[model samples]
Target chain A: MSNGASGAEAHSRTTAVALSDVNITFRLADSGSYTAVEGASLEVADGEFVAIVGPTGCGKSTLLNVTAGLFPPSQGRVDIFGANLAGLNRQSGYLFQSEALFPWKTALENVAIGLETAGTPQSEARARAQDWLTRVGLGHFGPRYPHMLSGGQRKRVGLAQVLIRDPKILLMDEPFGPLDAQTRQIMGNLLLDLWSADRKAVMFVTHDLEEAIALSDRVVIMSAGPAARIIGDWRVPLTRPRDTAEVKLDPEFHRLHRDIWQTLKAEVMKGYEQTGGG
Target chain B: MTRGRLLSLQFLIAVITLLAWHLATTVPIGGVTLLPPFFFSNPVDVAARIFKWFAEGTIWKHLWVTLIEAMLAFVIGSVAGVLIGFWFAQQPRVAAVFDPYVKAINALPRVVLAPIFTLWFGLGIWSKVALGVTLVFFIVFFNVYQGVKEVSPTVLANARMLGMNDRQLMRHVYWPSALSWMFSSLHTSVGFAVVGAVVGEYLGSAAGLGYIIQQAEGVFDVAGVFAGMFVLAAFVIAIDWLVTLTENRLLVWRPVAAETRTQA
Candidate 1:
């Protein structure tokens, strides 16, 4: 709405991805079904950076998977750029939580595969992939296999692999879940740098609230699951081009953090309790 | 550890074994022969027979015949394995339906089929190829199947997310994965391919190393049998070496245990 002045149909037009009253219930092996998310509705405006944050197993990833069309929501609609999503969201790039790289391919080949599959010539795709790899600070590591690289290095390649295709929307599910704290911050900043330069509709799901606040324009929260639903939404007031680590020092950042924590605390405690933890 | 030193050491070991064989066959112990020459020919006699065959060029025809049969079996069997393996992997229903039959066939000792193959294809190279195909097919089929099954789900999902069509997914995701497993099982399949050919020729064939060995054994020529076995051993070793070189070239991407550790 802020970007679009056109009346009536502007909401749907401006929206890059919309999930309306989605209910994802997975059928268990034993004839029973478990509802992971229920009545979840959210809209990501074109080029908007929205992060979905929640406690562990609160269906944070389920929402992203729904957006990705990895599986359909049991009961709702998913629209990509106002068009109904069918088999897959062709306009969106997905960064899986675990290692998704083809182990047999070199870093360059993995990054270029998206382009190659889309009918780009090998030479052109290879050139563009090289440029993207350099953007991710891995120009010389092109020949290395995924197993030869460290976790952080592999994450960089994954980023390049997804980004080289220039997807209109980015669907990330805990992209930094496996990294150490320092590497996580580094990756977060790198993500912001790339996203800021080429704005894309990003739905980043993470359990780390701090990460959600640092990288996203708006932070949305979900309660603990067996029917998890979005409980709160807050627009981050921090200015643009902010460093992920340095943003934490601001007073406004602390105030926003405190407010969200109070609401998140109960849900997090409930989440932990559900998992048989304290 | 150097290449030259390793080769010499291996040659020295071979010499010692031959020396032991010669002493056992030729030398008398307390005026009694430990290993009779008629049963176990001396190494020198076996060596001379091998030299004589090669020098006369009489072995080339049989070697060529056996190589042709083995090569045909390997090509046909591997291609069939790969095609069927991909089909079964992509179609779960088909795989499930054929599971019992597949298990039963694979469990049966395939050597028994040599006679049947000879009957169907005749006492020619085709029979030998058919026998070899039976041996090589299952080894490659299982490897391909395992390869496709073990492909990382995340990698497959990522490929799908890249907007790759079914054909592209097979080329990008499945083929390379399955190829790796197939290549890893190469030596076994190759050995089986040769074994199949030799066994078939032994059962009913006019040509091939197996035929010559059969002829020698029928005549009670122990030295000829020993010579034939040594040649077969050398031939197998040469093929295995080629396989190793091919594996190194193709699987260069595989992480070598010590040399290519995960880099930070």
Candidate 2:
């Protein structure tokens, strides 16, 4: 691709992530293979905030993992900033939905490890890790192990762990899925505050419709799986510096939510039906 | 339930049991001894024998020998176990190839290996240490394998995302995880190490706690046999206490479910 040539190509060159016609299939333990996502294509522009909201088990996380180069899509291509993706997308930082913090390490050490592994000296990495901890409102919690922290506090540390590395693309898979409603709202605000300071292309995955609309610049929806596809893409018209709680009261926010939900409701029911019996 | 009350209750049980034993051995009931002193050796004589051994400092050398053998075995076996365990865990193909062989070896009673070890290493401390190694190895090896497996996939994925290479992952993630698992079985493995040493020494050795018991048994000294057994029990408890301390130090990050209850 030679980093492309023309002005239009140059503009496309600024694309932070472009996954074109990606298909992901997983081989089972038996002599079988299951297709999760088929012909899935989406692009995240530089500094754009995008949320992929879908029903549970709709292979939404699989799509994010594909973007991260966690595994190659079985039948399609992944392109990062005009370069063909190969192994781990080095320019990205991923925040998993599960408990990923090393239980044996303190919060500070977990945050510092990224830099340390990249050859930064211990003193400098720890100092910067402390700064990141402070930014995430966990300045004094550096010494506490992951088990000792509350769920909300641990999420804060997780956020710090990713943000400390300052990756070009931040891939989050339901980063607030485990927290309570109140705590999720608080974390949503904290995430927006950090993203605003140093904007990156973020691909956030969640099932919470209200959350998807509240925090994102655009909302991407997916249909139910066994070859799930991106079904809808809607731009949120609400302005930034928007509080997650206050934005819900906006009539425009309601309109956008109503429109996205209309296309999403059928898929949500299908997902539930698939999971209902089992 | 309270600490002081529990301690007093435990002390009371011991005193009651000793009193019963003392009365049973010395006093005849219905013109026949309840527990003949020749067989049971009365609690008083057993206690006095233990006291005399300590007071004369004659038991220290043998105790030291057994402790040395057990400690060496523990160190060697645990190290080898951890290394091999890591090897088997990370390399699935190797693990798969060796799977049946590992199971077969583990299935074999470790005690049965003692005679062969003595034949190979002779009747010196190395043989006892070798025997102890066999006993300690499997407990740690299986635990370490489990620890590596028990490492949350999320944690490993996050570490990879954080840019840890294979060696770094081994150090920060795998080692700590395996070590925690090893510590969980600390009491069992340490007790096995002592058992291995004692068994090796008992079979045929010049000196050790086991040898002392063998020597006294050869002379038909019942009190001495009882005294040797008591000393071994006490020795094991002391080593177990030290294991507990080491476990506490190494696994401070491990969540203790009863920690809050115990503190309160």
Candidate 3:
């Protein structure tokens, strides 16, 4: 109840993102209601980096989408920046797991969209987008289309695209999920570097425990679904300026990994048995 | 294929086809025409008739009339289709309500409406334009509807999260998506627009390439009919070439398939 109740109480103080008793259910015509998340609550403090790790199909993304205001909870509440979120969450930016970029836009145009939407003149937006692309190491790729870039490069563009808006909260759903292992590490380090410069409330959803531990201030785990809820929360005590590849070697990292895995393994096994190893 | 080799192959094909056509029409078999020269004019006769039409500049007026009708139909139909498609796509309830009626209208043979259009707009260019509009509208409308429906939900969510208001979302997300689909269907719709115009003219018209062909057939002038067809084809090919050029320029963002053939 502390996990479910903390978000609502935290609202009395300043909190970046607070989801209180959020429940999401999909109405199927033939079948009855399919509950994805029930009584799930979480809170992210200002400038904190939090990662939610869980078994596959554990409704981790549904929680993030609720915070983004893309899907309203059937019951419960979502408060962002100390205010109730009505429709779209303007204070947050989302990086999707799939190819969310507009394939028709060049890298620069894609990055510049938020500024333009905010009524910045086209030229200023373009210049600022180019600067952000440079920061993401894609300055020269400004004119290139999404299809022309490699998967890693596109993720870099997606990073630049979301980060350019300067959203107070960043909701990333497995942003580097499509990358190779080596690229994922590089991106994780890059994300850490950018985040260290100016911290924001980041809710990163990933199933990779090592990635979650390497890049987060706190790690939250949700149970396997049919109405998934938060099962565990742990503070990551890893040092700053961390390299995702190098951080795994620490004994403390291994200890945290083992402890979290102990809780996570049971859910993973249950999920497998229920789906018949699907 | 190398450009030179491809061009040579194309030239060879045209020459062989023309030779076959010439021999079939002119050469008699068993003292009987294999294909009557009066009905199937020899390539040489058709070519001569085409050269004569160009020399006298008599085909220009008919070509102009047909071009105007097709262009008008293409412009008007595409604009209306896009506007309606966007409106219907954004309003799912309205779209569902009108879905069956739209399908019914689209399923109706547009050629059947040509006579009715002629009755309404007379035998002028408007009747032909109306017919062509009908042909172009449904292709664009259906493609646009599908484009809007098939829009990547992830991308839409991303756009919304990026703080795009309704107008910006439509302009940045929906418009570009629908435009891509519409552009992909342009080749088909453009061809159909010409078909509509010519068919309308053929059914009954005082002017246009179709009218010339119809008049030539009435007087048993096979060469004239073939000449008119050749001119019509050349005109359509030119328009198609322009459409392709515009498509390349606008859709530069689209991914091209890797060149499967080994590099030279």
Candidate 4:
């Protein structure tokens, strides 16, 4: 027992997240079973931002879900902060691909919910939530419910909602997938600015290649499914404080984009063939 | 439509209906009554009956009884329904076991149970309240169950990820989701509550507006019957208006039809 404890402590010092030989199979009572991810091993170091990019049906989100400890992999195990995760991860925050803010709560209340659930006094939670709303450029919109805000504004509230929790690891699944190009660019830059100040282990999942390259220290690509696995990994050597839009104009960015696309394009075509161009 | 236009149209419809009723009942055709006053009382006589009831203040006793019965039924039934609904939603195995029995009970004609309720609780306020509860319970129960069943998966996941325990999740998520559904059917459930009370009274009772109307029918006092009906209609409308106000205040986060029009 003491040996296990020492091993876990040592693992915690070096790794923020570790998934060893994870396999996820979804059961369909009528059609048998479908494997989403198979024999996938990965790790995120403390304070490292790793982006997983793949084809449309490549099971990227499934990988992120495993990291979040929402559900255990059908085979193998997940470790969070070096402890074997048996249930919901207590040390991570997730930003969903779609709107996940409580529609019944106003922006301030939504932001404060994490604290409120953790036993913070209502008044103190509200005060801190208000501060986060201001940080996200929604100071005046605190009293407005999610429905009253435009899409971009609601996304800002969602960001504040997760960020206010100060989770040791952040799992984002296409957090800006629904926005228009202009808003997406703005949100990307804002995220980078916020993240740079207090670096945490981040595992971002998206199909957007430019987004993955612009925002990550390492970009990992997964193969198309029937049992998808990590197919490629690239080190994003872009300098610090790089702008998402401006960085695209860089010659190095173009070269990396081309190299990554060479691998990604084939997987995308295979996925399309499997789905009959859905 | 504009509020002013809508109000004028409503007033016009009411005025035309009343004018037609008065003419049909009072006007003579070929020196003979078009419709006998005994069967269809004149508008003036109905109005007079209403005024007389108000002046005597006797109407208050019956009105108060009915109101109390309906309010009690609404509160008790809503609480039970919401609690049971949550339990069943949380325990699907229990729900599956009892599903057929519940359906059978719900499908049974509620009015037929009035005599049974009277036998169980005696022919007084409790019997009427029991009937009202049966009517109120099903609507609220089904709505609460449906609300919980249809709670957004993403929201549920988000709540769990926020480190909310079971009790916290219930208070913050399930309760609010159920409430929105309850308020959506507020008017209908409350309306059923009143119907259950009045019907139970009309079938067998010594007091209440329903009893008054039943009494008027026995003597062929058409004006008194019409007066009782008008009073009942007004009472329901007033109560429903109050329900609407409460719903508006509680569900301020929800978008209303009027707000939607302006938004677009």
Listed per model, the TM-scores of chain A against the true chain A are 0.95, 0.94, 0.94, 0.94
Candidate 2: CAPRI quality band: medium
TM-score of each predicted structure versus truth = 0.91, 0.96, 0.95, 0.95
Q: Residue by residue across B1-264, what tens digits does model 2's lDDT show? A: 999999999999999998998889998999888998887888878889999989999899999999999999999989999989988998889999999998998899877888899899999999999989988999999999999988998889889888889999989999999988998999999999999999999988998999999998898888999999999999999999887777767766777822532464
Which pairs of residues have clashing backbones in candidate 4? none
Task: Report the C-alpha lDDT of model 4 over A51-139, residue by residue, as the tens digit.
Answer: 99988877889888877888889998899878999889889999998878888899999999999999999999999999999999999
TM-score of 3: 0.95
Q: What ranking emerges by TM-score with the best candidate at the front? A: 2, 4, 3, 1
List candidate 2 stretches off by more than 4 Å: A1-13, B257-264
lDDT (10s digit) by residue, model 3, range B1-264: 988999999999999999989888888878987888988998998999999888999888889999999999999899989988988998999999999999999899988998899999999999999999998998898889888888999999988988888888888899999999999898999999999999999999999999999999999999999988999999999999888777777778876411211221
Best by TM-score: 2
lDDT of candidate 4 over B86-128, digit per residue (tens): 8898999999999998899999889999999889988789899
Please tell me what DockQ candidate 1 reaches: 0.66
lDDT of 1 by residue, B1-264 (tens): 987899999999999999998998999999988899999999989989999999999999999999999999999999999999988988999999999999999898877888888889999899999989988999999899889988998888899998889898888889999999999999999999999988888888999989988889999999999999989889989999888777777876677621322221
Q: What does each candidate score in C-alpha RMSD?
A: 3.7, 3.8, 3.5, 4.7
Q: Which scores better on TM-score, 1 or 4? A: 4
**Taking the tens digit of each residue's C-alpha lDDT, what string does model 1 give over A105-216?**
9999999999999989999999999999999999999998898899999999999999999999999999999999999999999999999887888999998888888887
| Candidate 2 residue pairs in clash (backbone atoms < 3 Å) | none
lDDT at A131, model 4 = 97
Model 2 Cα displacement at B100 (Å)? 2.0
